[model samples]
Target: MPLRTWQTTLCSFVIAGALVGAAGSATVTPALAQGPSAPADFTAIARERMPAVIAITARQRVRERETAPALPEDLPFREFFRRYFEERMDPREALGAGFVISPGGHVVTNDHVMGNAEEVQVVFGTSTRGPVRLVGRDPATDLAVLKVDPPPRMMVTAWGDSDAAEPGSWAIAIGSPFGLGGTVRVGVISAQSRDIRSGPYDDYLQTDALINRGNSGGPLFNARGEVIGVDTAIFSPIGGNVGIGFAVPSRVTRSVTDQLIRTGWVERGHIGVSLQELTPANAQALGRPNEMGVLVAAVEPGGPAARAGLRVGDIVTAFSGNPVESGRHLSRAVAAAKPGTEARITVFGDGRTKELA
Candidate 1:
C-alpha cells in the first residue's frame, strides 16, 4: 500500500555523510599568493558548529530479479532452468550531509542527495546515529528536509537575510565531501542572483569557494556566521570547482525550507509563457538598440500572461521592478509572484512601448 498523501509527498534524499573534499570548496586554490589571515575565532567556530552538521547515508532497494509469468505449461526444461536460476537480490546505500536547523531534529540538505533513497539515516556529533524520516522536498530549488530525534545539544546556525549579502563579502563553507567528514573552505561572494541554467528559478549566489561533489547542500556562511546561501552547484569544464561555484541564496532557501517543513511542498505561481532573449539582429529589426529584454514566442491559453493580453512578438523589458534580460529571469520572477497578484510589466510591441498589468 502507498503511504498517506502527506507521507508519499515527502522528500526522499540523503543528507551529508563522509564527503571527501577533493578540490574541496575552492574553485581555484591559490598556491602562488599567501592567503589572507584566517578568522580570529576559526577554531571556536568549527568546534561550536561541527556538532550541528550531520552526515546522512541513504540506501535504495534495488530489485535484481523481477518475476515474469511462467511460460505456457509446455515450456522446455532448458528455458525453465534459465528462468529459475535468476536470483532475487537487494542492494542499498547512499550518502550526503545536512545541518541541524531546528531543535526538534529538523535538518536541511540537497534534494537530489535523497531522491530514490529507500532508507535514510543520520549520524549525530556524539557518534550516535539513527534513521531519519523525510519531511518534505523541493527539486525546483534542490533542497530537502529530514527529521530525526537528536540530542538537545545539537548546535544551530542563524539565518541572515541574503538581500544584504553583497558581492565581495567573505564566505565560508562547511560540509563533508567524498565521505570525508567535516571540512572547511573560505572565499568571497563573487556574484549574486547568478542564473546557472540549472532550474527554472536559477537565482544562485556565485562564490569562489571550492565546492566539490560532496559540498552539495552545505551552508555558505557570511563572516558573521549567519547562513546566507546553500551550496548547490559548480561550473567546471572538468567537473570540479574551478573558481565558479553556485549556491541557492538564503532568500530562496528560507522560503522553500519553511514550506517544506510546514506544508510538504512549494506552492509556486505559474504564468505560462514561452520566451526568448532579444538578439542584436532581432533587436535591430524591432527598432531596439542596446536594449536587454525577453521576447515572447508563445503564450499559453488562459495563462496569466495570456489573460493579461501578452502576445507573441512582444519584448518584455521588465517585470515588477526587476529587469528581465532573458526568459529564465522572467520565468523566475513570474513563478515567485503570488498567483492572484497583479504584475507590472514593460513591453515593446507593434512599434510602441507600453506598460501593462
Candidate 2:
C-alpha cells in the first residue's frame, strides 16, 4: 500500500480507540469542578476555533535508488548482463496542521511537519490556498513559524496559559487528520509534564484526543477555545493514535516561537556540565538524603560552569533559589535562563554547602 493510504487506514482504525481510551485506568478531574458549568456545547468552541486552524502541505524532493528484482538462480545468465540503474528523484508530500497566530500571517506548527521542505502551501477553510514562507524553526522544541500573505481580517487563535492547564480539563484538537481537513477531536488532558524522551527539553502535555499522523502541528485548545498546546507526536506501537498523544505545551511553544520570530533561532543558556541523577545508593555514599539533587559528573574546561568554579562530585541542589528536583529540572531551568545573566547556584560538596554566583 502507498504510504498515504496506509496512514489513512491507520487513522480510521484507531478513531474509536482514541475516543474510548480516555476512560481507561487514568484519573481525571470532574469537568464541572474545572470551571463554570460544563461547556454546554463543544460545537460552538469548534466553530469558533476552526477558522484559525489550517491544513499544511509540504513538498520535498527525495532521491531513491531502484532495487534489483529477485530472479531464479537456475534461469539466468545474470553475470552476462549488466543492470542499467539510475536513482529516481521523487517528489513527496507531507500533510500537517497549523493555526494562524497573528493577523499579519504568522502561522505556528511543528518543525517536524515543515521538515526541510522545498515548498509549503497553507490551506484555510476548505479552498483558500496560499504559499507560505518559512520564517523560523526550532528543532529542540519541534516548533516552527511560517509567514503567509493572508487576506485581511483573518481569524487568529490566542495562546492559553499551558501552566494553568490541569489534567482532566477538556482538550480539543483541531487539525487535518489523514488529510481530512477541519477535523476536531475532543478529549481530556490525561496528564501533564510528560517526558516522552523526544529531546533534551521533553516537557509535553499528554492528551487522549485523536491526534493521528496528519495532526502534527495542530492546536490543542482548552475549554476556553484558547490554544494550550501544539500536537506533536503519539506513543503508538501500531502507528496509530493509542490515546497517548503528546503536545508541545504552549508555555514552551510561546517562548520558542517568540524567539524564533525575533531571531530566527533559539538561544538557550548553557552551563557546560555533565550531570547524573542522584540515586539512593549514590546519595547514601555522599552522606545525603536519597535522590536529593543532580550530581555534577564533569565540567567543561572553559564553560560557564567551570568558570563559576563548579567541579566534579558537586551536588547541585538548586538554581537561582529554585530547588532542583532532578537532572531534568536543573537542565530545564538552565535552558530557560537568559544567556549572560548571572545566577545563584547552590551546591553541596566536601561535607559543606556553598552558594556560587
Candidate 3:
C-alpha cells in the first residue's frame, strides 16, 4: 500500500496478535496532573494502575490473505500450484489489552478488538483468565463492553476527567504492546479532540506514548492514576509505533460504556425529520419568497417531529431557540440532544410563525 494509504488505512488495522490462532474502561476522577512546574511519577502510576489492565484475545481460526498475488504468466505447473499453494493462511490468535471497569466484570475495549469473532477471552496477569461475553458495542465511538465472570477481587480502573487533559500533559500508557507482557511507555498528551477521519464521532486524544498493534484497547493514564484515554490507533509507515497514536478520550468512553452497561445500546436522539436546503425552487414550490432556513423534506408519520406538528414543507427556522442556519446545522443540533427530553422548535408555516414541542 502507498504511504498515504497506510496512513489512513492503519487506523482500524493497528491490531496485535500472533499467527497461532486469531485476533481481536474506568472513569476515574481526574487526578490533577502534576502542575506545569512538576512531574507525576509515571512508574508509580503504572504500578498502581497496571493491575486493572488485562489482555484480551478474540479467536479466529486460519484465514487467507486479503488479496492473493496474481498468477505468473505462462506458468507451466498451474494444476500443482493451484491445488496446494492457493491461499493457505496460518492459525492465529488475536491479542490486545483492556481494563476491568466493574468488580462484577464489565470490561472496556475498542469495538475493533472484538471485531466479528465469536470467542473472546480476557486475562489479568497470569492468574486470572476466562472467556468474556460481548455486552454492547458503539462503533461510532469505537467503544465496547465485555462481561466476564468476576474474580474474587478484580481491580476496577477509575475514569479521569479527559476534558481536563491538556496538550503537553504527562501521558503514561500501559498495555500488552506487541502481545508481549504488560509494557509501559511515557509521553505527553500531544493534543486532544483529534479527528483522524476514522468515524463521524472522531474525537480522539493524540498521544506520543508508545502504543503498538497490541495497545489498541489499553489505558492512557494521567499523573493521578486515572484513565484519561483508551489507546486505540496509531499512524505508522512500517506497522510499528512511530510515536503518533490516538486514544478514545475518557469522556466519550465513560458516556458510551455507561449506556452500554445499563441498556446494552446507546440511545441517539433524533427528531425524525428529513430536511433539505431551502433553495429558490423549493421556496417557490412552498409559496415562500425567502429561502433562508431548512425545509422539511419529509417527516416520519409518528416521529417526534411529526407528533410535534412538523410536516413536509415546514420551514424550520430554529431549534431550541438557536438559529438553524442550514440543514447540517439543524441535523447536528437535533442529534446532539438527549433522548426523552422536550424542546421547542420554531417553524415558519401556514403563512405564520409558530413554536412546537
Candidate 4:
C-alpha cells in the first residue's frame, strides 16, 4: 500500500457498560476493567524531551512552469496564449522535525527532509538556527545527521534499546506537525520489525502516534524519554493521521547516524550474491528434509562470494557461524559485517555441506 504523510487529529469515544443485579439494581463497572490501567501522565516526559525536538525547514531551488491561461475558442487570442508561458526557477521550503542527539550539536533526522535541501534551518524553542551543515545521510535507512552550533546549554535525548520495544508499550512522538512546532502526541507501539518496503534495512517500529508530514525526521520516545525511533512515513488514505505510522528503529538510527557523523557516509559490507527463499521443492531437490536457509540465486563475478567460491544452487546455511533463517536474515547479517573482514560461510550444495571463508 502507498504510504501517505500523516497529520490530523484523533477522535476517541468512551462506552460505558452496566450490570443488573437480581434486585433490579444497576451496577457500574470501572472503565479500567476493560483493559490495562490508564496510562501514566506523559506530561513530565513530554516536557523533558520537547526542548530537544526541533523543527526543520529545508529550502531548495525548484523549477516552476507557467501554465497558459484559458482563452475562448472563438477568440483570436487563443494562439497568442501559448506564447506567454515560461518556466522560472523558484525557492521552495519543506518543513519537518529533528532531535538533538548530542551536546556537540549533532541532530538526527530523516534523510528525505534534508537530503536535497540547499539551505537547512533548525527551530528550537522560538530560536531559529540557519544553514545547518549536513554531516551525512544514509538513504538506505532514511536517516540523516546535521551539525549546528547549539546554544551553550542544549538538551540532548539518549537512545533507548529499540529491540526491547514491544507491541502495546507506550510510545510518545514529538514533532512539528503542519508547521506547528513542539507538538506532542502519545500512543503505543503497535508493532515492531515492520518491513514497509521503504528500504532494504526496513526494521521499522509501527505506532499509532500522531505522526504527520512535519513529523518526519522527528523522535519517537519511550516512557523514559529515550529516543527509540525516528518518525519517517505514515500509512494514511486521506493525507492525514489515521493512527498508523512507521519509524526507523533507534538501533538502526544509532548505527547509521554514528557512522554518518564520524565518516560522512555509511560503509555496508557487501557479499555480492542474489538470494531467494529456500523452497520445499528446492530443499527436496537438494536432498534436504525441510526448507531452511537461503538459496543462492546468482553470484556476482569478482565479488566476495565469487572469490570465496560460492556457486549457484548453493544454499547458505550460516554466515560467520550465525544460522541463516531467511533471505532478510542473511542480508542483515552480511551487511552488518565490517568490510574486508573474513567471514566463515557454510553452504549446502552438491548433496554435501562445505565451509568457505
Number of the top-ranking candidate, with TM-score as the measure: 2
Q: Write the per-residue lDDT of candidate 1 for residues 255-309, one digit (tens) a residue.
A: 8889899889887766677888888998888766556998889988877667667
lDDT for each residue of candidate 4 in 1-357, tens digit (9 for 90 to 100) = 654332222222111111112234578875753545554699999888888989999989987788877777898866666655656688988889999999989999988998578888899989988658889988998888999888867999999999988898889999999899999999999999888877777789999998987999999998888999999999989977899999999998988898998899998878889999999998998766468789999998987778767899989887766677888877877777777666667788776677776
Stretches off by above 4 angstroms in model 3 are 1-37, 62-90, 273-336, 344-357
lDDT, candidate 2, 93-202, per-residue tens: 98999999988889999999989799888888876667678889989899999998876678899989998889988999999998999999999999989888888999
Q: Report RMSD (Å) for each prediction in the order shown.
A: 13.6, 14.1, 13.8, 15.4
Quote the positional error of residue 154 for candidate 2 in Å.
0.2
Residue-pair clashes, model 4: 2
Worst 10-residue lDDT window, candidate 3: 6-15
| Residue 323 CA displacement from its true place in model 2, Å | 1.1
Candidate 4: 10-residue stretch with minimal lDDT: 12-21
lDDT of 1 at 48: 68
**Distance from true location, Cα of 339 in model 1, Å:** 1.9
Steric overlap count per candidate: 30, 0, 16, 2
Q: What ranking emerges by TM-score with the best candidate at the front?
A: 2, 4, 1, 3
State candidate 1's TM-score: 0.78
**1-357 per-residue lDDT for model 3 (tens digits):** 432111111001110111121122355787866655555356678777888898888876676744435678688976667755666656566778898888888889888988877677787887657767889999987899999888776688999999898998888898887677579989999898787878756778999999887788889998888999999999999877789999999987887899999999987667777888898897777655577789998997877777667778889887776777787667645655677666667787766677675
Which parts of model 2 are misplaced by more than 4 Å?
Answer: 1-34, 69-86
